[model samples]
Target: MTGNTHIVGGIAASLAYAQFTNHDPIIMLAAGVVGALLPDICHTGSKIGRKLPLLAKLVNKLFGHRTFTHSLLFLVMMAAILNAFMPFEAVTAGILVGMVSHYLLDMATKNGIKLLFPIKLTVRLPITTKTGSKVETIVFSALTLLSFYFGYEAFRFYL
Candidate 1:
């Protein structure tokens, strides 16, 4: 999926969190957006990767794309790291949820992610598509609509 699609997925996750939690929506939304793009930082060609070229190149050379960062191990390690350093439970939840959403979105593609790394198990959805294909374009459009609706619902009062 494209970064734009991942971003919409993040928005959807954040909006869902906002619907249930009493945590600050603004913070959650920001974390969601950032987290969605974080996993792809392994690929230098990726959106966040382009911004942080050195880190992205290092990661790409060290582990290659979609290996460590896209794994469940990474998620657990991230949660632990955030728990130790961030200390903001709600924002942590938002970031994790956003990253999970990114993984699931990637699962919908032909190049499925190794959700469990070092085990060589590539988890994938039965229904899949080529990345950046027509299917992704449609999914992106639909997710965009969902984001707009959720955004309006979540922020309408302030608007």
Candidate 2:
């Protein structure tokens, strides 16, 4: 998926996590957004990638696209890593939800991610569409709308 789609998915995931856990909505939202972008650090062209090009290039050289970073193993590892520092259940939940959202969004694209990695199985939805295609645009728009609605509700309830 494109950056916009990833961003929308991140925001939506964070909002949902906040609503579900009754944690600090702002912190969850921020963590979720960051977590969503974390996996794409391997791609030199991604927003986060550009910020740390050397690290991104190193990751790409070692793992390549849709390999280690896009796998369930990676998600689990990340959750564990975050859990150590965050300790808080709500923060860990937000991170996991954000990562899952990123994986799911990539699955919806034509070139599905290597979810299982070493297993070499690419899990994708039945509906096949290119990233940033018309279908993706529509999906992104819907996600954006949902994100906005959730944000408004969160603000009304919390602030």
Candidate 3:
């Protein structure tokens, strides 16, 4: 999946979560975006990678793309690190949800991801598509619509 699709997936997941949780939407939205992009740090060509080239390169060299960074172990490590800096439990939940969303989106791609790393096993959805194919564009559009729907459902309580 492309960065934009992952972003929309993040937003959609975050907003849906906001509907049930009491966390601030703005904060959750921001965290969601960050978390969604964080897994792609191993890819130097990724949106987040472009912004932090040195870190991306280092990670890529250390673990290669889609290996450790996209694994459950990485998620646990991220949760621990995020908890140290972000005292708010909601923020951590939002970010982790977004990261999960990222993994799910990538599973739809042909390349798949190492969701259980260190085991060298690649996981993917039964139906997969090319990264930027028409199917991905459709998925992106659907996620966008879901984002809007979830946003409206979540924020309606405030209005």
Per-model TM against the reference: 0.94, 0.93, 0.96
Which candidate leads in lDDT? Answer: 3
RMSD of each: 1.2, 1.4, 1.0
Q: Which lDDT tens digits does candidate 3 get at residues 1-159?
A: 999999999999988887788888878888898889989999999999999999999999999999898999999999999899989887898899899999999999899999999889999999999999999999999999999898888778778
Query: lDDT value for candidate 3?
Result: 0.92
Instruction: For candidate 3, list the clashing residue pairs, or say none.
Output: none
Q: lDDT score, residue 26, model 3?
A: 78
lDDT of 2 by residue, 1-159 (tens): 888788889989899767766788787788788778888998999978999999999999999987788899999898778878876776777777888898888888878888998788888878878987898899899989989988887889555
**Residues 96-155 of candidate 1: C-alpha lDDT, one tens digit per residue:** 878998999999988899899867888889999988899999999888888788778888
Clashing pairs in 2: none
How much is 118 displaced in model 2, in angstroms?
A: 1.6
The lDDT per prediction is: 0.88, 0.84, 0.92
Which has the better lDDT: candidate 1, or candidate 3?
3
Candidate order by lDDT, decreasing, is 3, 1, 2
TM-score of 3: 0.96
Best by TM-score: 3
